[model samples]
Target: RGLFPSFFREAQRREVLLEDLLYVSSAFERIAEATEEMLAEMEDSLRKPVDPEEFRHFWLALAEDLEREL
Candidate 1:
């Protein structure tokens, strides 16, 4: 029947959307974890003595790496 075909199509569309959403959610989780780890490392570095120029370069490189991962 026509109604049955439409129902199946809509269901398929919803399934695809759900899959996309899950993939995005996983990506966000990964990004968040990576960001948290980076922040913790920065915090630890702050607790110790670090050269300003060295820290600046390290921070910039970390930012670039984070941007690529995201």
Candidate 2:
């Protein structure tokens, strides 16, 4: 996951001990799972036709919130 790569690099750059880094890296799995679920939901939504303007707004808001969450 992008978060892991960036976080791992940051921890290493700061000379964090491997044990500490390992603990921090443990959170990556949950983050990755959440990301995958969100993507899959978006893909499923795209499989069906929806009102263009409404769907656009829905996806745009979702994207904005996800970006903030990430």
Candidate 3:
């Protein structure tokens, strides 16, 4: 069984090629990288002393950036 059996079956019926799968795999990698970077920034912020309002703004901005990426 595959992760998305129906979708995979449809894709196979459509004769989807390896390159198409690779392209989607790469896109997912990019999204994962962005998420990791955002989490690292948040972790660093927590390690340091920051003003409450400033931290809130920083967190919100990071969240927005992540939303845009996804």
Candidate 4:
């Protein structure tokens, strides 16, 4: 990935171990899994929803994830 070189550079500077790098990779995988699940559950109907609570919960989860990214 475009970011891989930069990540490796920083990892080298920090002397991060191969084991720690594996853990970091796992973190990215978890994020991917969560994102896929959220989309599966909500994105197909992201435009709008009939139920008030479903609308609220979906937007809240999306907003939380956005904030976490920032």
Count of clashing residue pairs in every prediction: 0, 0, 0, 0
Q: Weakest 10 consecutive residues, lDDT, candidate 4?
A: 41-50
Q: For residue 57, what is the lDDT in candidate 2? A: 98
Q: For each candidate, C-alpha RMSD in Å? A: 11.1, 16.9, 14.6, 16.0
Model 2, range 1-70, lDDT digits (tens) per residue? 7999999899887776776778778788778999999999999987978788998999999999999999
Best by TM-score: 1
Prediction 3 TM-score vs. true: 0.48
Q: Write down the TM-score for model 4.
A: 0.41
Alpha-carbon shift of residue 17 in model 2 (angstroms): 3.6
Candidate 2 local distance difference test against the native: 0.88
- Candidate 2 accuracy as TM-score: 0.41
Would you list the C-alpha lDDT of every candidate in the order shown? 0.97, 0.88, 0.90, 0.88
- Flag clash pairs in model 3: none
Clashing pairs in 4: none
What are the models' TM-scores?
0.69, 0.41, 0.48, 0.41
User: What is residue 42's positional error in candidate 3, in angstroms?
Assistant: 0.6
Give the better candidate number (3 or 4) by lDDT: 3
lDDT tens digits, residues 1-70, model 3?
5669988888886666677788899999999999999999999977997799988999999999999999
Better of 1 and 3 by lDDT: 1
